[model samples]
Target: MEAKLDLPFDADKMLAGLQRWVECESPTHDAEAVNRMMAMAGRHLALMGATVETIPGRMGFGDCVRARFPHESREKGILVLAHLDTVHPVGTLAQGLPFKRVGDKAYGPGIQDMKGGTYLAVEAIGQLIKAGIPTSKPVTVLLTSDEEVGSPSTRDLIQAEAARHSVVLVPEPARPDGGVVTGRYAIARFNLRTTGRPSHAGARLGEGRSAIREMCKQIIAIEEMTTEACTFSVGLIHGGQWVNCVATHCDAEALSMAKRQEDLDAAVERMLSLKPTGNEVHLQVTRGVTRPVWEPDDKVLALHAQAEALAKRLGFALPHESSGGGSDGNFTGAMGIPTLDGLGIQGALAHTLQEHVQISSMVPRAKLFAGLLQNV
Candidate 1:
C-alpha cells in the first residue's frame, strides 16, 4: 500500500478555523446569525481563489453561499455540499457549550456535527490549489444555511446543481466508527392540529369536547406505527392552557423515518388519513419537511468502491453504511446522480451539548477527502 497523503495544514490551524466556525453559532432559525457565519466562510473561500455568490434567504432563513472554482474543461465536475447552519442557537457557546479541546478531542455544539466538515472541505480546496494540482474537473462548493431545518430554501438549488455535476459529495460528519454513509432514510415531518369546542371544567366538563384528549389517542396510534423498517415519534406537543377550562386546541409536531421511499409514502398517507376520534373534534395534518430516502444504485455503489480503494491506499478501512439521519445527499442521490456522503471528519454526538470530534482524525480525514477530490 502507498503512504498516506499529507494534509495541507497542521492541527493548530485546523483547530483555529474550527473554533471560529463554532463560535459563530449559525442556528438554522437565526437568519442574521447564519448570515454572519456565511460571511466568514465566504471570506475564506475568496482567499482560496474561489468566486463566491450569495443566494438570498427566503422564508426567514440566512442567505446561502456558493463558491465555484472554474476550470477549462467543459465536462461535468464535482459538487461539494456543505451546510453552514447548525442546530445550535446563537448563545449556545455562552450557554455552556464551550469550544475547547480535551486530550485530542474538541467539544462544541456544532463542531462535530458540521462546522468541522465545512472547514475540512475549505482547507482541502486550499491545499489543492496551493499544491498546483491542475483541476481535473470543475468544482462547485455549496454552503446552504437551512440544512438543520431541512433546507427549505436551498433544496431546489441543490437539485439543480446536482443535475449538472457528475458526482455530489456531502461533507456531513462521518459516523462514530469513522465510516462514511452510503444511504439515508427518508424523513417526513408533520404538523398536526386538533380543534374542538371548549367548556368550563367545573361547570360543564361533560359537555366539552377536549382536543387534548382526542390528540392523546391519536398520538398513541401514531406511536404504534413504528416497525423495524419505519419509526415514528412525536417530538413536540402543546395543548392545555388553564386547569379550570377544557382544552380547545392541541398542536403537535411528529416525524417519521423509513428506509424505503414507497414505505414512507404509505406511512405518511396513513397518518394523513386519520379521522377525529372525539365528538366535535377535527384533526388537521399538514406535511412539513420531506426528504426522500437515498437508496444506493449501481453508480453510487461504484463510487463507494472507488472511495474504499482510496481509503485502503491510505491504510484504513472505509466502511460505507446506511444512516437513519437524512442530509442533502438524499436529495441528489435520490435524483439518480452518483453521490457519496459522510466524507467529512470523523465525529459523534452531533446536535447535542456533548457533541465532539477526535482532534487527531482531522488531518487524516482531510487528506483522504483531498485524495478523493482529485480522483473522483
Candidate 2:
C-alpha cells in the first residue's frame, strides 16, 4: 500500500506568510534591510522550536541566520539553503511590483526568485512539527543575506556548514519547465575601469582622451569574446560626471559563465589581457567573486533520484537538468556533497518587474518539500 503525508499548513496561510516576506524588501547591498529580514526569519524559526543563531555579517554584508531543527540524534543531517537578499532596491514595492495576487499568479519583488521557496520550506517544517511528524534526520536551514551579489561574504560559511551535513537542498526557484537543478555552470564576475585625460568639451575636444569612449570599446571587445563554450556580458557601467567636460574615468562590471572550468579559466585570462585602444587612455581589469562549476556525481544523482521518487509518490513528475545560473548549491555540490537545487516555487521572469509565483503551485510544492523532509 502507498503511504500518505499530511501537511498542516494550507495555501492561504502560506501566501500570507510569503507576502510578509516579499513586502520586507531586503536588497543585498542594504545590510540593515537584510538584517531586518533575517530577524523576521529567525523569529519564525524560533517559534518552530529550532535552535537558531544569527551570525554577524562580515565584509559589509548582512547577517546570516542558521537554524537547526530539534531531533533525537545528533548525527549529520540535511541542509536547506536559501538567501534573503534580492537584486531589487528599496522603494521597488511602492514604485512598482507591490505584492498582489492576480488569477493564478502572485507578483512581487523576490517572490518567485526565492522568498516564496524559503518561506514554504520553513512552513513545511513548521507544519511537520504541528503534525508530530519526525524527519529521518536533523535539518539545518541557513538563510544568508548575500547571494544575488555572488555570496562573497557567506561562501566560506556555506562550505563549512555544508561540510557537517550529509545532503544539501537549495530552494532557488524551480526551473521554467518545473524541473530541478542537478548541476550548475561556472560563473565569474569582472570589474573593469578605464582612465583617460580630461579636457573642456567645448574648448579642447581634440586634446582630451575620453575614458567613456575607451570603456565602450572595451565592453564591445569583451562581449565579442563569447563562444559556444563560454558567454560574456557587461551589465553595469558608470562613467562621465559632467556633460561639458570629457570623462576622465569610467568603471563597469561584466559577467562570464561557462559549462566547464577550463573554459571559464581561459575566459578570465582573456578578460585580464584587455589592452587600451589608445595610448592616452589606460585600462584595468580585476576579477571578482566566482562560483565554481558543479558537475553532478554519483552521490548527487542518487539524492536527486530520491527526490524524484518522492515527487512521484506525491503525484508529480520531477525532471532535472544542469542549469546556468549558479546558487549556493554550486559551493556544496562542488565540494562533493550530495546536493539538489531548484526545489523552490515554480514561476517565471525572475529578477524582473513581472516576477511572480504560481499561486496554485504553493500547496503542492510545500507538500513536496514536506515529503522530502520526512523521507529524504
Candidate 3:
C-alpha cells in the first residue's frame, strides 16, 4: 500500500501570502529590491521554526536565504531550490501588472514566473510542520536571488549546495499542462562591442566608419547562425552618443540556446570567432555566463516517477518533458544529481505583462509539494 499524505493546504491563505511576495517586486537587476524579498522569505521561514541563514550577495546581487527544517538524520536529503528575483521591474506591479484576480486567474508581477510556486512550497512545508509530520529525509530550502540573470552570483553556491543534497526540486513555474521539467536546454550569453572612428556627421561623414552600422551587420550575421539544433538572438544593444556625430562605439548582448552540449559548444566557438567585416572597425566578443544542458538520467527519471505516482494519488496526471528554458535545476542535473523541476503552480505567459497563475492550481500543487516533502 502507498503511504498516506495529509496536506491541509488553504488556497486563500496561500494567495494572501503570495500577494505579499508579488507586491514586493524583486527584479533581478535591483539588488535592494531582491534583498527585500529575501528578507521577507527569511522571516517566513523563521516563523515556521526552520533555521534560516542569509548569505550576502556578491557582484552587486541580492542576498540568498537558506532554511533547513528540523530532521533526525544528517544524511543528504531534499534541496528545494527557488529564486526570488523576477524579470519584471519594481514599478511593474504598480503600473503594468498590478496584483488582482479575475475569474480563475491571479494576475501580478512574478506570480507565475515563480512567486506563486515559491509561496506554495513554503506553505507545503509549513503544513507538514503544523501536522507534526516528519519527512523521509531532511529538507533545505535555498532561495536564490540572481537566477533571473543566468545566476551569475549564485551559480557556485547552488552547485555546492546541490552537492550536499540528495536531490534538487526547482519550483520554477509549472508547465501549462501541469507537467514537470526533467531536462533543460543549454544556454550561453555573449557581449559584443564595436569600435569605429567618430566624426562630425555633416562635415566629415565620409571619414567616419559607423560602429552602429557595423554592429547591425554583425547582429544579422550572429542571428543568421541559428540552425535546427541551435538558435541565437541579439536582445540588447546600445550605441551612438549623438545624432550629429558618427557613432564611435556600439555594444550589444546576444543569447544562444541549444538542445545539446555539443551543439552549444559549436555555437559558442562560432560566436567567439566572429570578426568585423572591414578593417576600419574593431570588434570584440566576450563570453558571459552559461547554463549547461541538463539531460535526465535514470535517477532523475526515478524521482519523476515517484512524483508522478504522488500526483496520480491526488487525482492529477503528471506528464513531464525536456523543456527549452534554463533553471537552477540545470546546474544540479548536470552535476549528475537527480533533479526535478517546474513543480510550481501551473500558469501561462511567463515574463509577460499578462503573467498570471491559475487559482485552482494552488491547492493541488501545494499538496503535491507536501507529498514530495514527506515521502521523497
Candidate 4:
C-alpha cells in the first residue's frame, strides 16, 4: 500500500457546501428547523447516488437522517456519525453570528461545532465516488437530530445502527491543536427541587421553613463533590417570587462529569443520597441525561494509531487528545465498538458566538477523511 494517495478535495466547493449547511440553522429542540436541515442533507446524499432514509423524529426532536453507500457485501462496514442539530437556537444567525469569512476563518453558529465536520464527511464521500475508489465495506452516514441535547431521542437508534458496523468515525471537531479526540468524559444531569412552607419574612419569619435555605445547603454539598476526576456544578436554579416572603419552592439543574464510570457512579450515588439539612424542608432529585464514558480501549487506540499514520502520510502529525466534552461517539465507544472522534474539520470556539472553522484546513482534512473511508 502507498503511504499517500492522491485524493482530490476542492476547498472552494467544500466551503460553499458548508456555508449552505450553516445557513440552515437546526437547533436541537426545533423539529421544523431540523427537519428542514435534514431535507437539505438528504438531497445532497441522494445526488451522490446514496440510498437515503429519513427516520421520523421521536421524543419531540427533529428527524434523523441515514444514508448508505452500499457495497457488494451487505455485512459490517464503516459508520460515519454526525449530528444535524446544534446548540444554537433559532435566530442566532441574525444575532451578529451570520455566516461570514473574516480572513481565513469562517464564522457562523453551527460551523465549528459541527456543521463543517458534517459537510466534510459529505465531500469526502463524494470524492471517493468520483475517483471510483473501491472499498471492501460499505459506508454509512448517520446525521442525528439531538446530539447537542445528549441524543435523548436518537440514543437507541445510534446504538442499534452502530452495532451493525465494524468501525465508527465521528466528525465532531478537531481540538485547538488540530488533534483528534481519543476518549471522552461521561456526563450526567439532574433536576433538584426543594419544598417548604411560605410565610411573610417580616412578620412570620420564625414560622417559615425556607426552601432557599434548604437548597443552599444542597448546593454546597453538591459543590463539595467536585474533584480532579469528577466535577459537579449547579448550572440552573430557580426559586422565590417575592423578597418579603419566605421562599416556598426552589429548583435547580445540576451536571456531573467524570473520566470513568466508577467515578460517575460514585458521584451519582452521593447526589441521590443527599438529605435535607433544614427541618420541614423536603428535597427531591431526578436524574436526567446520562451518557456513559467513552474510554479509549485497545480497539479505539488502534484506530487512533491508524489515523495518526494516515495523517503522517499527508505530511502532518495527527495527534490525539482525550476530551472533556461528549459526543455521539461516546455511545458507540461505550457499546464496545471501535470508535474514533474528532475526524471533522479543524475549528475553534465551539458553541460560542465566535465559533468558526479554518477555511484553509477544509481540503486537507477532507482528504484525510476520504483516505480513511477508503483505507479503513
In terms of lDDT, the best-performing candidate is 3
Better of 1 and 2 by TM-score: 2
Question: Positional deviation of 15 in candidate 2, in angstroms?
Answer: 0.5
Rank the models by lDDT, top first: 3, 2, 4, 1
Residue-level lDDT tens digits of model 4 in 1-376: 4323587677877788788999999999899999999999999999998999999998899998999986888879999999989989999999869999988999998998899999998888888788888654799999999998788889999999999999999999988788898889999988999999999999999999999999999999899979998999997899999999999999999999999899999988988888888669999998888899988889888988888888887878888877888899889998999998998888888889999999988887887887787777
- TM for every model, in the order presented, reads 0.95, 0.98, 0.98, 0.93
- Candidate 1, residues 1-376, lDDT tens digits: the string is 2323675668789899889888988899989999999999999898888899998999998999989996888899999998988888877898878998999889997897799988998888788788876545789999998887778788998999889999988889888778888899999999999997899999999989998998999999999999997899997899989988899999999999999988899889988898888558999999998999998888889999988887877778888988988899999988999888898888778888888988888887888778777877
Residue pairs whose backbone atoms clash in candidate 2: none
For candidate 4, list the clashing residue pairs, or say none.
none
**RMSD value for candidate 3:** 1.1
- How would you encode candidate 2's per-residue C-alpha lDDT over 1-376 as one tens digit per residue? 2224556567887899999999999999999999999999999999999999999999999999999998998989999999999999999999888999999999999998799999989988888888888887899999998999899999999999999999888888998877899999999999999999999999999999999999999999889989999999999999999998999999999999999999999999999898999888999999999999999998888888888887877778889999998899899999999998999999999999999999887887788888888766
- Alpha-carbon shift of residue 35 in model 1 (angstroms): 0.9
Q: Any runs in candidate 2 off by more than 4 Å, and if so which?
A: 1-4
Which should have the higher lDDT, number 1 or number 2?
2
